[model samples]
Target: MSGHIAQDWEPVVIRKKGVAAGQRRDEKAVNEARRSGGPIETIKKFNAGSNKAATSTPGINTKKLDDETEELAHERVPTDLKKNIIQARTEKKLTQAQLAQLINEKPQVIQEYESGKAIPNQQIISKLERALGAKLRNKK
Candidate 1:
């Protein structure tokens, strides 16, 4: 019947169970050993159905290159393409830097193409052809 009713309030504390102290110390030691690159014992579980070869090492490159792939690996811009680029650029009276600016490319790119050191790029070749009014690709 009172305007305000009084009630008892009780505070309760709850604690969560965590890893045991010995287990935590063992984990810390294992982490430290891994960070320091020290050898650690690896336990391999027995699996009867695992088809993986036990003697094979992981991440080893076992691939052998074929003749075609080997040739492609050493491929560069053709000498003819380099000569054409140089000739067209010179006939236009454009310096390497000036031609590069006209094609919106770097001067080093023009130099590389002229020196036959650049890898063939069709898009850049097309841009150069349009800018210099010449055909740079080989005819089949």
Candidate 2:
């Protein structure tokens, strides 16, 4: 043909490793890694001094209020409720161990109530009442 000779063309290669091996690569992988906390190796690779300076404000307080504590302080079992449980169990001829089994509670817990060592929550009191077929609360 003419005075110029034809040259064979080859595609340009931008990456030699990772997903885009032997082809063109972009910042997509790097951007994703930055947005999400990337692999462990990448996380450990960074030691940016600017990050510490950026955290100047103290973190928010996440502790919730103690509503249960306040409510229980006022909703205690009546002083004579334990006596009622003892009276009911005696009338039914059921031992503390048997009563505890009926209510799905430990025998020692029943003992604690009889001995006035533990003031159970409302749920336990309700369970005890159901198991003994008695009302342990004072009639008002």
Candidate 3:
């Protein structure tokens, strides 16, 4: 039985189509074109008609520009609000860090508010007003 089993068992060699011998046909063409300095067409082309002409120019009416500037001004903490905050905080004898702690905010937030760079937040402003005992909004 052992001699019969030895005769039946044989080594099998499995060969897989080894990685397509080298560079693929299309890749080789691209590489050759690069080496030869031939102009290869781009995959995407700019549509000349799709681009819109510049609407706003120096000679154009600036009402729209003024409206945009006003909108940007409204988005940030007002300069007067910042000044009021600084004055109130100073009058209360509190440092920026101390005022921030009192209002449950970070010192950087207080710094941003004082510098008029803070995005106006009603909740934070309310907290600041309460902490400083001052009105901080809509003061001309």
Candidate 4:
């Protein structure tokens, strides 16, 4: 009896320069576009157009806004409201995943609301109420 091992151990050829150069160019273009607050498509087009890196992407403003004039908007959803949402969803015998599908939202969104990690906007709240057949909003 003869024991024979079958194996194909061929050394792989690595062509780094071509692939690496392309990836580097793409990364550089994307970074430039992001820093300038320009659309990513602009980077793609710029890269497709020429080998030179663009100093500025036209039709994009790179000005910084003052914090005093910029108001950070946040919706205040009461903890009771979060409880209401969870209660209603449970009463309907629906999982957060199911509720998300019925309401056309991601499951993570439902989970976030239930866990009090997020306050959904008015539009989403309305959808949730309809799906769970419960009133989530407080009468004000």
TM-score of each: 0.53, 0.44, 0.48, 0.47
* Ranked by TM-score, top first: 1, 3, 4, 2
lDDT over C-alpha atoms for residue 128 of model 3: 93
Per-residue lDDT tens digits for candidate 1, residues 1-140, read 66888788999889798867534446677787789898765455676578577646654444432223534365689998999999999999999999999989999999989998888888999999999999988897
Residue-level lDDT tens digits of model 2 in 1-140: 66888799999979665655323234666566658776422344354765765555535322234233444343344569878989999999999999999999999988888877786677888998898888888768
* Candidate 2 backbone collisions, by pair: none
Which residue window of length 10 is worst by lDDT in model 4?
Answer: 58-67
Regions of candidate 1 where Cα sits further than 4 Å from its true position: 1-18, 22-74
Clashing pairs counted in every model:
0, 0, 0, 0
What is the lDDT for 136 in model 2? 89
Number of the candidate with higher TM-score, 2 or 3: 3
Give residue 13's lDDT in candidate 4 (0 to 100): 92
Model 3 agreement with the true structure over 1-140: per-residue lDDT tens digits:
55654457789999996646443346677688789898655355456566435553554567666656543345788888899999999999999999999999999999999898889899999999999998988744
Q: What's model 1's TM-score?
A: 0.53
Q: Using lDDT as the measure, name the better of candidate 2 and candidate 3.
A: 3
> Which runs of model 4 end up more than 4 angstroms from their true locations?
1-73
Q: Enumerate residue pairs that collide in model 4.
A: none
- Of candidate 3, the 10-residue stretch with the lowest lDDT total is 51-60
